[model samples]
Target: MMMKAVLVDDEPLALGFLKRQLEKVSSIQVLETFTYFDSSSNISVIKETDIVFMDIEMPERNGFQLAEQLLELNPGLEIIFVTAFNQYAVQAFEVHALDYILKPVQTERLKKTVKRAEERINAKQEAISEKPTKLCINVSGELMFHLTNKDPEIVTWRTLRARELFLYLLHNRDRSINKDVLTELLWAEVDQEKAYAQLYTTIYHIRKTLSNYRDYLTLKSVQGGYKLILSNTIIDLYVWEKKLKNLSTLEGQTIPIAEELMAIYKGGYLQEYGYVWAEAERVRLEQQWVEAAQQLAAYYHDQGNFSSAERWYRELCNKHPDDEISNYQLFKLYALTGKNKLAEKQYQIFKKALEDIGTGVPHTMEKWYMNWKQGIARKTSM
Candidate 1:
């Protein structure tokens, strides 16, 4: 497997040496090099990088801090710290670095590190290949389905109409769709006879495409409409909504289950499809997500658990940056947790985001911040 590698060192000489050594490893591809860590330049590329050859000692931030940031962007990223000092050996291992090699780098030692990285990459690929195949209908992002076995191939449709028809049926799987209505909606400009013929052709291709999973699923024409006979299909939207419905019955204790349900929602329903029919369900699912996140954040904050509250709010903000409420709550939680710098940063970002949308900070938010500021001042005076 070709591994994407990044080299980072303040010393240009060390970087050059390491880059040359890495070039000898046929498996490693040096995608980029950085002498310093900056969020804008580093985080974007580092998120997609597999391995990083980092220098333990550096100006501004040490290798450990850079590793921490990289791991935050991608937890699966393997870091190998290269430093001349032995004092940082224990600290290097503490961060779960892939390997630590002493500078004045020996070829044998570097090769050992590369071997370990290969083993890790191979193991991950094997684990993925071992997962049981399922017909996964992903409505949270692009409307697509794929078998999750072997190469994990995506099921492609013959046409856009065929894909949309499949998505519409899946979205409304609880009931069968009327054949006539579907034809009119999908092919409104075409003649009724031509539209019906086209619809049937699309259905034929869809069935042919999903022929492998025929034992577990089938398309059936019943009464005046078609229904998907999915005895063993995994629809993400259905599963997510079902889990959310169960959360209400948990009687006030809904933390663990709520979190699990919320995490299943990768994005809005059929978000990339941009179909008008999907908007209602998409909006409904998104609202459910927002409500669940708000309740969880509020529950933790009210219990005086600022750390957990901050985490949930920050997650919400990351997913929905335009969510002013989540941003505001996160800002307050940061202050309560004695993260004044983070609180100020969150406030500034929130202010700028609102301004970009042609609005100023909400008066209520301003009032809350003023009150908090006054409280902080009183405490500092004492």
Candidate 2:
């Protein structure tokens, strides 16, 4: 059967735009739309609806409230968030929403996401959901609960277990966790089948709680495992990764876009969370941070801000003493500021450091020494 959909929005144009887009999706059919709240009678139009494309801010009865009542009427209804963005990302992650779309939705993004939704619908039609009735994903430092039932209000982080489970998925947001692994970590060795059942129970309870914001978070099953799908616009950590990739191409003497990028680096991509792959990302970002610092130092040095330039270059050298460029920059910055002795000392240190690491100091350092000698000869003649 084709996936049936209902669009609930307070704006007429927004509803129209979605209806037209769904027309192209091939698999999704719009059952109805509500630009304004009417009667409970409206629910009848979508009695067989598979998914609700819901907007959070609506007239009279808000979408959240409306969704609650509608779910009360039919507990099996699925939801997808369509918000212009109201700090919804975290809540979305916690609630286990299927997917979310932002305002002015791009056609390509919408089409691709709808295709995935269709896949989910087909999979559900065939898969044995005997595993768990609900899915609860921790949104890092918070609990986002979802289940078949519908509740409108948001969830808060209260217990240690809530925090633990939520942070686990948030840290591993990109990767799926195996049920067997979760069972081992959560319940330890217990009876095999019993532990599996207990694991399902935890996920079910978490899901049941998260069902409140079902439109925002989506925990999907695939290949004998499950994965937490997150929105890039909602995740600043992802934004940083994008900026860092482009930053390497920036060579010299431009505005500090890299610095602006670095400024937005908020605590290392869900810093408090931990997972097996988290350290690899941490190391990656740390290296990027160091690289940005080096670039900013060079930019400032060229701008004649000797103090700021030296400050950054010194940090790069101190943190990564073996970096040849950082050492050379330090020496150059010192020389420019009329600290010849300091410059000579840094060059000496660079040579010794490189020798200790079994590599020759690059020819660039030798030029600094040649210039120093030339200047001394000129001074003696004067």
Candidate 3:
């Protein structure tokens, strides 16, 4: 495997030297070089590379901080610290650095590092290959299924009615859906005999498609109805709700689980399908996300960790921009954290957002802003 690599060093000479040395390794393909860590540049580079050779002393960001952010952007990214200081070797390894090399890197040492990188990359691939293939159904935004093996299976319907029928049964999985209800929902415009025939043909195609996936799925005909059953399958909605339930009952230091829960919510439930039956569940899951985000934000803010609180609040706004209460809370956090510019910017955006929705700003918000300004003035005066 040809590993795509990036070099990040503030010193031009050091960056050049590393680039030249890396070129000696036939397995490594240099994708990009950066003198400083700019979020925009680094993130773009990260999307195309597997390894980042980072320097310890950059102007604004040190190697450790850059490494953390890089991993957050691409968790599988391998980081190798190339620096002059041997003192940082312990710290670099602690952060899961693949290898640490000091200034004036030896060609042999560099060769060994390249070999280790190849080994680590191969091991990761082998581990992924050994894992069981998961069946993931996204009933949140798109009606789709993905095998953990990475190839997505697109269900082609013999007729549009066939697709809708399968979705109906999936929506009411485990419960037998009555034939009359199915007919009314999917075939109301057709004649009785013809409608029944259509349903039968649709069910046949569904069964045929599912036949090969018997280990993962099943469709059964019950007395006067049909039922869809899933085995070893993961539905995002079910997982999100389960995580929400678990996280809601717990208090304090729930960041780890909160992060997991946030990842599970792909988007509004079955949004692409736009079936009337999905709206209620969609609304319910959205509320769960809101509560989870709010709780995490409050937890971080209460802990005097403004940075983490800001991150969660920003995510909340992305999901629910109309949440004025959250916007106000975020504004307060920004002001308290001494981000006066961001606080003011948030207020303007919030005000305009409310006006666009025809609600205008509330009296409570006006009063709160006045009090906040007064407090700021008092601090400034003192």
Candidate 4:
């Protein structure tokens, strides 16, 4: 398959040389070349192009910053940073560039880069074509959709209002919402007629955008408002929750299944989107995850699996820094294991966590710490 590429270099000579060399490669098709990014015209082409060959140094905007903007437009777009200096190699990969080639570019090296880009593009295409038709939506970390065999891609909404309206419907999918309720929630500032008109236009845009997934999703006009019906759809949050509910107890055999379920709850529900309406459900789901994690951690602790217990408890503490139970458990585990310094550090952290919330350690916890400290002192004296 022929892969499309775009080149960006401030120097006309270097840009021409790279373009000419790419033309020699049979698989690559140079689509456009830019001396520097013209925010207006270049963005559309960048979105359409498959790969970008860019220089590290430029006058208008450095290649790193421009590459970032381009990747934001098309996350799948492969970036190959070509520069004379080798020091930028580390930073180039940090931004997830495909390859770093130094100038003056060599024929053999350019061929290798082109071959790699072609393989990557072909792999992505094959992945999409290989799988059966299935719709997967992930709202755990962010709003992303995977249709058929394609990789998960974030929906680029036509407008902010369009995005918000779609998410609102999705949050309350399978049920018809009232038009008055939606208008009041989203377009309260506008006049009634204008709000309704804007709503109609936004709905039209959404339907046009989702026309490709007509088999799996349907945005229907109900008696009053609209309903988003999902068919043959696998939502990550739903699958995780359902599996979690089915697991009655965590046993030696069941531990792995429970661990898999924990992994499915990637992050708080719709956490990245920050939709105020999603907050309640997010909190509820988070609490469920915490309860399950607590159960798993307690089981490991009881089974004398200190390493696994510490791993899960630390994960819990990382997710919920002010979780008193996990913090105290870690403290006890470390103290009993004769790691007194780690125990002390954990105790201090627990104290500070509570203090941050305008509280202090509970009397029972304080008493336990004091007793442990006295015991340590006695042992030292002995």
Best of the candidates, lDDT: 4
RMSD of 1: 26.0
lDDT value for model 4: 0.88
What would the per-residue lDDT of candidate 1 be over residues 34-106, giving only the tens digit for each residue? 7876855667688778899989889978999988878868867999999999899899999989898998889
Note the residue pairs that clash in candidate 4.
Answer: none
Q: Which sections of candidate 4 miss by over 4 Å? A: 1-132, 380-382
- lDDT for each residue of candidate 3 in 1-382, tens digit (9 for 90 to 100): 9999999999999899999988898999999888977766557779778899999977877999989888868868899999998899999999989999988888899999989999999998896788677788877776778888777667666777687788888878889999889888888899888888888888899888777677677887789999898877988788778867866443556677778778777788877777787789889888887887888888888888889889989888767666887988988888888898888888888887778888876788778888988888898999
List, residue by residue over 127-214, the lDDT tens digit for candidate 2. Answer: 5445434333322222234343444223654444444555566666769888777667666769879987776666666566545445
In order, candidate lDDTs are 0.83, 0.68, 0.84, 0.88
Q: By descending TM-score, how would the candidates be arranged?
A: 4, 3, 1, 2
Which ten-residue region of model 2 has the weakest summed lDDT? 135-144
> Cα RMSD (Å) between model 3 and the true structure?
24.9
Q: Of the pair 3 and 4, which is ahead by TM-score?
A: 4
Count of backbone clashes for each model?
0, 14, 1, 0
Local accuracy of candidate 4 as per-residue lDDT tens digits, 191-281: 9999999899999999987888887789989899999998778888888899899997788899999998898888998898787889999
Q: Which of candidates 1 and 3 is the stronger one according to TM-score?
A: 3
TM-score against truth, every candidate: 0.55, 0.44, 0.57, 0.63
